[model samples]
Target chain A: MLKHTPFHDFHVQQGAKLVDFAGWEMPLLYRSILDEHEQTRKSGSIFDVSHMGRLHFSGKDAVTFLNKVLTRNISEQKAGQSRYSLVCNESGGVMDDVIISRDVKNWILVCNASNREKLVKHFTKVRHDLDLDFDMSDQTEGTAMVALQGPKVIERVAGVLPVDIKALKRYQFESGSYMGMLKFTIFRSGYTGEDGVEVIIPAKIAGMAIKLIAGKTDKPDATIKPAGLGARDTLRLEAGMPLYGHELTQTIDPLSAGLGWAVDLNKDFIGVEPLRKIQADGPKRRLVGLELEGQRIARQGTPVLLNGQPIGEVTSGTMSPTLQKSIAMAYVDAAHATEGTTLAADLKGTQVPAKVVKLPFYKRAQ
Target chain B: MLRKKAMPDAPKDYRYLESHEWHKREADGTITLGITQIAADELTDITYVALPKVGDTVTANQRWGDIESVKATSDLYTGVSGTIAAVNNELTKNPGLVNSDPYNAGWMIKIKPSNAGEFDKLLSMDDYRKKTGH
Candidate 1:
């Protein structure tokens, strides 16, 4: 049986096309993928991100335990600030990419929905092996998450939220209670390359919270319409963000995936040694962006060819709604991973000409 | 319990395959072929349509072409064996027409069917709706 999020019924009411995502029955699209994508780019859209794992940590050893496992130095993180980080195995391969936030009293970690259970087990084992004394609890089922993302999101959301979310810089967060009843945390962060806030509220008050935040207008042309996982994937791909299962797998290292900035080589983490070696020797293959000639999408595992020989494989591809072109991310031989280099994607037997481009296919204007 | 989805209107005079292709027999004895609205909705945001060349032979229940969306790809099949009379070139540049207007402007091909009796073998509007659980 598939698990349903707190907003499952809300999705159904909005005429969402529901699909199984990471063992959860989630909305693929509320109206249509293209419509929602355009809506997010142009105005604002609300995304149900409740399926993602939310773990809280407390106790004296919390910072120490996090510093031992996470790629980033968690001890340096300030209260109400979030930092993007990665969890790597002993071999320096990425386990999951996550966001670690230092709240006022406790620490919060948001990870991919698919990696939640595995991560909980891994954290537990690590704590036991290290004989640490932190209280780690998975708060996913007890809370709900919603991301209101787009250029217009901040202004409108600021009117309803208790705190002045517009004043919060990127990666900053604030906690407050609505109507002195519904307690929530608003994080000025999102997966989509847009200015927005992700709000977490108690699971029981999800329906009431959405109503309060989005307002009473539920028309199709409402400023904040409900988008789904489909638009979220496309938006992130356009933003050049690497997804856990697609780009950062168990065998793929963060350095090779062009995420070295998130890894701290100076810190003593679980995978720091191998990562240091990888940084010294350089990555064998580097992740690069590709713009195909036409609308033919180079799907995952499609071979990227140079001079008719396979050089790499595509990780993710989409006919970008924002760019109106076929864009993909692939790991190519480091020698050929330069902007404007010509390559081809072997779709079945046909070769579609591709050109290496910059990582992000779309960027919002400041 | 999931709510029953209302079936998109399938023309009474047209015949449909379980795979979602619809065939309409024209007055000129040619059959116009296109995917049903259900197929278009399922394959959201179609990005490309690869149709067989004009005058190419298409076999019954065989793959004639391919249609691509942002997230998935599906092979196009025909219910009637025929010579490709004409293919819609507009779909190459604007495949979204398939989703917006699947019946008329989105018609993929017009085939000069070899066996006219094949149309009768296809499912009627009522049967197709029942089979698809509308």
Candidate 2:
């Protein structure tokens, strides 16, 4: 049986095409994929992201334990601030990417839902060895997450929330009452490379909050069409962000994925030695972005060719709605990963010509 | 951001195929062919349509061209074997027409059929609907 979120009924009412995603019935799109993609790029768009895992940790020793387990230095994470981080196995292989936020009273480690159970087990192992006096609890079931993203996000969400959201900078959060009743937490962060805030509230009031923000009029009817998982994939791909299962996995390290900046070498964390040794030996292959000539998209696992020989494979790709061109992210041989390098992607037995460009194929206007 | 309108039933004037292409016998012994409305809705937001050249010979139940959307790409198969007489040049710049007016302006090609009796073997509108389970 597939699980349903608090807003499942809301999605049905909006004429969304529902599909089973990660064992959960989720909306794939409301009207059309192109419409939703264009709307988010031009104005604003809302998304239901309640599938993520939210873990709470507190106590004097919480900070010390998290710093030892995560890739980023947690001691530098100030109150009300969030930092992008990662967790790795002993081999320096990426387990999962996370966001560690220090709330007003506790610390929250947000992870991908598909990796929740594995991460929970990874966290449980830390308790047996360390003398840390903290407790780890999963708050994912009790809470719901919604992301409002775009250039007009702050201007549109301002009318719904009670506080001035403009005062909050990136990677900051604050707890407040939603419409003067339900307690909520709003984070000025999102996966899409757009100005937005992620709102977390109790599961019961999640539908009401979505109605308030997405409803066309003052009534509770949800007239505003919501974006689905398809648009979410394209949005993140256009932003050049990494997906856990795609660009990151048990055999892929963060350094080879071009995410080494997030790892703090000064701190002694799990997998530090393997990371240092890999750095000394250099990565065999590196991830790079490629721009195809036309609308023919190269899908995941498509072999990337350099001079008629396979070099690597594409991890994620899409016809970028913002760029109006075919673009992809792939791990190519270190010698062929440089910018301006010409390459070919074997798309359905046809070697379509491509070019190794910069990481991001599209960036929003300032 | 063109919104998809509620698709109507397949026009009875043309014969449908299980692969979703529709073709009709023209008065001059040639035939006009395009995709069905159900196929259009399945491939939403058509961005590019790659049709064969004017003189190309298309075999029955075989892949000849391609259509692409924002998220995926699909091969286009024709149910009738014919020599292409005319191609829809307008679809080069406007492929979404294949989704909006799939039966008319979105028509892909006009072909000179190798066997005119092939249209009788194609699926009727009622049979097509049942095959698609629409």
For all the models shown, what interface RMSD does each have?
Answer: 4.9, 5.4
Per residue, candidate 1 scores C-alpha lDDT tens digits across A158-177 of 89877988789999999999
Report clash pairs, candidate 1. none
lDDT of each: 0.91, 0.84
lDDT of 1 at B17: 90
TM-scores for all candidates: the values are: 0.97, 0.92
State the DockQ of every prediction. 0.47, 0.40
A142-212: candidate 2 lDDT, tens digit per residue: 88888888788787778778867899999998888965787888899987788888988899999888877
Q: What's the TM for model 2?
A: 0.92
| Alpha carbon deviation, residue A329, candidate 1 (Å) | 0.5
The parts of candidate 1 lying over 4 Å away from their true place are: B1-5, B130-134
DockQ, structure candidate 2: 0.40
